[model samples]
Target chain A: METTETLNETQLITKDQLLNQWLGQRKVTRRVLDAFPEKELFEFTIGGMRTYAQLTKEMLAMDGATAKGVATGEWSTLDEEKSELTTKADLLASWDESTEKIQKYWKQISIKNFQEKVVAFGQYEGTGYSILFYVMDNEIHHRGQGYVYLRALGITPPNFWEQY
Target chain B: METTETLNETQLITKDQLLNQWLGQRKVTRRVLDAFPEKELFEFTIGGMRTYAQLTKEMLAMDGATAKGVATGEWSTLDEEKSELTTKADLLASWDESTEKIQKYWKQISIKNFQEKVVAFGQYEGTGYSILFYVMDNEIHHRGQGYVYLRALGITPPNFWEQY
Candidate 1:
């Protein structure tokens, strides 16, 4: 397979940009959650699937694990039991906690540390780089679903490209 | 604003897993696209944003525009003109083209490349990253919107996290 070389040595992103991106993602997620009716959240699905609320619960579980990984710098050592977040408030609280944890951990990352190889668990073993991609990607994948859920309920989510 | 580090290394992601993740995203997108009513696609918005069709057009415009900074590589360029995509077929075709391009580029990336900084175009400013987290995140973010749109139309997307 042909491999592309890295971009020229450039500090392309600053701490502020990263922070803004994370915050923006959280903001969108909050809006999506707020727009849905509580009853519909658990029942809405295309095809045979769990509702958005179920997905939120799953996210809450993962956030707890990811937080542990970030706090200790040990991704492979985190537990995998599903955490139950039964209410929207619980989900939001969990989201806030995870966001705080992620923010704290992001600050500790240096440009050099991104390149360092590390082991990752869940859905086949992978490196730190790939694992991090999974974390962010998973959130996005579900967020898109939230939009569909919102539209079904006649609510429009904020623009995907807009900041704040 | 704090930045945190991922504990897992980059080497853990296998090619199969990466492909699976990409495929899964496409599947979810397709489901959302299928649910849209042709009439509502162009003007639909949640929270005062453009509809999925509008978003798709924006994605299409990124291709073949050097100034738009969405061209294959070249991250320093910037273009502000928003191109219009006339039909769903055109938008879908453009989406197909972009996905192919993205896959082609992604295949060229290796474990080592994930850690290197990359200046990706098509954002507020030409920002860079060691990992392609933003790209995947961007896709997922939009995909989530598709889900909401589907819900609003009383259509359900397939179970995204389910194993076939």
Candidate 2:
């Protein structure tokens, strides 16, 4: 509400720390994706839920592009229509590409820029920090589902807390 | 990172909008909680995964306490190793309390304070904004697991995007 007149210097965190945290979560999520058995990754669903492959694609479609939009001030419409990712190896490769894109574009965003807002993907409008957080959140959300899928298939998932 | 010095006026959104967006996701997560059958909610697990009830409690432990900490500079340690909640209704009631607490404490946080950092729950040091975003992200992540549990139990989960 603007009542706090002076900026609090003690509370500030370096931009590097924030970005690293987000990237750490991404690393854990990629492991979640890899835990899935190849067949189940694309075929397993309970009660009409989408497969882990589909969910991964949904995450892939947004994260890199959203960060790019935030960094460059350009918003492009995305095609939500996705084809099946037939193999786990292929999906993992695509996930690696997205992670690289995030690292590359992340350098373009300044700490002050995180407070700025943008209409991400030509739709939802929010601060750069909020939108980027959504992408990260969305990945974690889907990864949770992947954990469930792994369990259902009688496979143990990678530890959830070992992101770093 | 500060090389692009020109101010971008169009990329801005109010704090209220950001909070509402987070609340909208929380609403859908509540619906996910509702979809679970009582017995399965607490007991169902695959490959030794935590029950959906456990995941929900983990979320509850963080959200309300987090907002309180960000609003004020103090954080109270939560007892995570507590006993069972016993009933679905009781769990949901506790969840409602946490949600209400978030709303109440959110007002205490000033916009400028979001940039300030804090060590949330005696760990995970990050900015107020990043910490709050983690709370929201953690909820979404666990909620995704709930969706999987529902599906595995032969129940149809609510639409994911219907949160907004």
Candidate 3:
């Protein structure tokens, strides 16, 4: 493939591996969301933390926008305002939607794109690869909060390592 | 470089890049640790989450052990029981110590070891590469909890993207 043919000597992980990593993290995060009881997800906050519901919205918005931004090199911020999660169903639906959207646009990205620099949301600057990792990394961070929240609420989060 | 000459066609990121990424993340996480107030570091909990101090200890334990395990392939489980952090000074001191240990041992890991499968702590099965990523990824997750905690405490977190 042209992508492989053009691989930089410095690169050590394949694009496929990175994509799978991204998707797998999302799967585990979705389980954590599913584990939440409807009331506590939005209401539970320790030390003035945002509710898991609120944090999940931030993840969804970033995922959807970053998917587009990485594909098109145009970051959109205005439309990604705080979304309401009236129920666990709403949250899960949004999560699945973003995942599908990510897969869809991920096809448009070429190996060249991964190395091209782009300013995400017209603010944070990174290569296509770093930005993608940033989106995935941010999700993990928020998911950790869910873990803490779950434990505090006396529920066990999905094993973070169970990602496949 | 024997390591580079032996690279699998599937690898896309170099070992140096991964190590730098790992270290850069720790740099940012340390900043997060420093930002916490002495009292809040241990005293704060949201919805029953572990305090930042407790969370940091977990990161320190995992980092120190994983460094050794990756270098020696002898995972040590008995020695990493959380040490007392009577103050923030003690915590930062330990964090610095773990960082040194990771650097010293990272030299022992080669491209071959990364692909070699080993069960971490006699339970989690993954390649050296995957296990290394897990340690870095876990820090980000917990560092995020610190972000929420800081925000809840009404302080802004260090810009996460600032990693060099």
Candidate 4:
């Protein structure tokens, strides 16, 4: 609501700072994925939650495509189904690819574009930054589940605040 | 990592912009909680997820306390267990109170303080912004599940993009 008003000279965060934060959390999440047993990664569910592997696929499908969509204003990206990669290795490979895609596409998004609203996948709509925040938030959401799943299975998640 | 280097001459997002973005998301999350059926708000669970009311309590307990914790280097604040709010109306009231607390405590935190490293609740540690980001991420994670629970319960969630 207040975003429409004239901005002050000082900024809350820089583009690089934001990206670094995202990437750092991503690293922690990757470790969370790795901490899981191979079978549990694909088969385990806690309290009606999806398996970690399926959650990873969901993140993979949306993030890279979502980044591309934001940079280009294309909505069809959401139509792409979640990655079908089954094995842990394959899933990690796909995850790494999406991470790269996010970085590459992120560079294409202008600072001014962050405030422009776009309809993502033709349903949920928000500004470029909000959508990006949603993607990051979505990843953290699933990752948090992974943390719980790990602890339930007697494994500890990676340090969440180790990103420096 | 890049924070150690010389600072940039211009900022990417102002302090107001960041706060506005956070408040906007909080508004969306509140709407999500409000959308739940009164009975389900406390008793409902989808696939092992906490009830919306419980999840709201977790958020309420952490956020305002976290803001206060950041403003002052206080670790004991984390010991304040989540509110035992049983009813939906009570939970919403607690939620409203925390929102106000966040606004009040947030102002006490200096911009420079955001970059300082401190241990929270005698466990997690990170720069001020990273810790704050974790709190926000934690909220969205639970809120996202609440959204799913709503869909499972045959209710429509508030538009996420409406935060603009």
Candidate 5:
């Protein structure tokens, strides 16, 4: 406790800015989601791995669900039933829904809440900030897979740096 | 500015914890980096895409370079001369160097600095926090590529969720 208290105390950035920064990642990720060719999105795979569309499903399930949990102090297991997505359009529509959910639930998180501890998705015990970073990190990790899939399919992916 | 002013301020986590979180990521990425076969590390490409080893070189260059720049208010383009790595062992060694650089430079960052904007690498401009997130996001994105490549070669990747 003394160490925590002694470490430092500063906002660094506002909560809104943090949210916007996260939203920026989501936007850029959305573009990556869009860049996939339809048939390839759901069917293409390297070796026996799942397709990029399948990877996006995991992201869609986590992004909003985890944030909403952090914001409201409620953790639900990943709802695989709800995420039974089939096509790229279905996945994109779900992505948009998750984005809306993020926007709505994000405002519920005061700056103090970011420091509060929570169990993400009913597992992964950590602070809200770490959990948020986890969500973003997971998306980025999978998005990297999407980029590989696109390249393998002879398609160019959206520029990784362009998130705006 | 008004909203920024109104938000409550806190560190949420310690510098050591944050660095560990990043190191945890690097550790996972290192496993992914190691999973690549010798030939596949440099030559395997999906439709003319850069090899996984080449992708990792980009990660090695950016990860430390960006954070070091933020810490010292100095931005230099990636030291490709240093990252002229070829073998997987070479890449992993550079990865370790970057990890050390992250630990060393991370301490130099005060809490207030995370809020200050900087032109990372003399190019991308954003707050210290955003820039840091960018560094992590980039790594995750490319690691995803490594995962695909591993799968394409019929090699199982390290579990994506496990970072410890």
Candidate 6:
């Protein structure tokens, strides 16, 4: 039902929309992290098993992994091994590193290959776009959790829609 | 500087991060939309620009454009001529349509293509991955603006780090 012109336009728009969504999440995450009192970062929990600091650590690890994937042509898999970062500063620093890697790696993607499907890992197989979307979605979910953590700590995060 | 094994692992991690990020943004956007009084949706604005409703309409249109590109494997371009949605319902409906399309289209990407380059219009010309990141980043930028608008309206947005 869609013409070629229509489809082309959609692809471009989709790319932009996804990018915007990720940036918003990043801002929110940063605000949430900053709102936390250093003392509560490690012990704060809402759903019984969630810790504010632990979640942040996971976020850093995940971002690092995604950046690595983009940098290399190969998809990474999670082993039973849990990666750890000791402090907020360390986590933030790692996040910075991952962000750089992600930017560098993204520069390598070509138009022709955006839609190819390769099995990224066990039970996780989809086209390159899907995988990328998945990565973004995962961050958002965790970030939402971070929001809750901020609230429990009696801190108001920045507005979700704020651009700056 | 990185080994192949390390790169592969990072790729996998990146995919997860991307997905998480997407989910987080969606949650925040939904909250922003929900917080708006129905009548205010069409009139809300931070600067002199169009309101959140207007921006959402633009986002939906862009989604269609992005979908077209993925379906046809061609680069999508934006039209110089702009169109606007007249009502909140119209904008909301359009947003829904775009969300569905984005999800569907993302299923078509492959891991090997994450590094392939594409001619993304605008200031930067880079890989598909870069473009994807751009889209995510762009949404966040705009969403942050939405937050400022919310604050101006005296609405308390959810804490950015909340676990919900």
Per-residue lDDT of candidate 3, residues A1-164 (tens digit): 56633443334455755777788889999999999999998798866767888888888888977878878987887344455658899889989998998888887876667656899898888777677777788788889878877887789788977887
> Which stretches of model 6 miss by more than 4 angstroms?
A1-10, A14-21, A79-84, A121-123, B1-164
**Ten contiguous residues with the weakest lDDT in model 2 chain B:** B3-12
Q: Which is better, 2 or 4, measured by DockQ? A: 2
Candidates 2 and 3, the one with greater DockQ: 3
Clash count, candidate 4: 5
For every model shown, what is its TM-score relative to the native structure?
0.59, 0.77, 0.81, 0.70, 0.88, 0.47
What does candidate 6's lDDT look like per residue over B1-164, in tens digits? Answer: 24423433223234434445555665666676667777777776533545777656555545545534533456555642235556666656666776676667666654334444556444345555555655654554455445555655678765554312
**lDDT over C-alpha atoms for residue A47 of model 6:** 32
Using TM-score as the measure, name the better of candidate 1 and candidate 4: 4
Best by DockQ: 5
Give the Cα lDDT of each candidate.
0.55, 0.76, 0.79, 0.73, 0.78, 0.55
Task: Quickly count the clashes in candidate 3.
Answer: 10
Off by over 4 Å in 5: A1-9, A81-84, B1-9, B81-84
Native contacts retained per candidate? 0.30, 0.44, 0.49, 0.26, 0.75, 0.00
Error of 3 at B53 (Å): 2.7
DockQ of all predictions against the true structure, Cα-based: 0.21, 0.35, 0.38, 0.22, 0.49, 0.04
Question: CA shift at B161, candidate 2, in angstroms?
Answer: 2.4
What order do you get sorting by lDDT, best first?
3, 5, 2, 4, 1, 6
Local error of candidate 6 at residue A75 (angstroms) = 2.9
Chain A accuracy as TM-score for every candidate:
0.76, 0.88, 0.89, 0.88, 0.88, 0.77
Q: List the residue pairs that clash in candidate 3.
A: A11-B12, A11-B13, A12-B11, A12-B12, A12-B13, A12-B14, A13-B12, A13-B13, A46-B46, A46-B47
lDDT digits (tens) for residues A34-153 of candidate 5: 898888877778778877777787787788987788889998788654446877778889989998999999878766777688978776788888888788888888888777777767
Off by over 4 Å in 2: A1-18, A72-85, A107-131, B1-18, B81-84, B110-130
DockQ of 2: 0.35
- Model 1 Cα lDDT, one tens digit per residue, B112-158: 34334344553444332322434546656776666666656667666
User: Candidate 5 or 6, higher lDDT?
Assistant: 5
Restricted to chain B, the TM-score per model reads 0.68, 0.89, 0.90, 0.88, 0.88, 0.74
lDDT of 6 at B75: 57
- Locate the minimum summed-lDDT window of 10 residues in model 6 chain B: B4-13
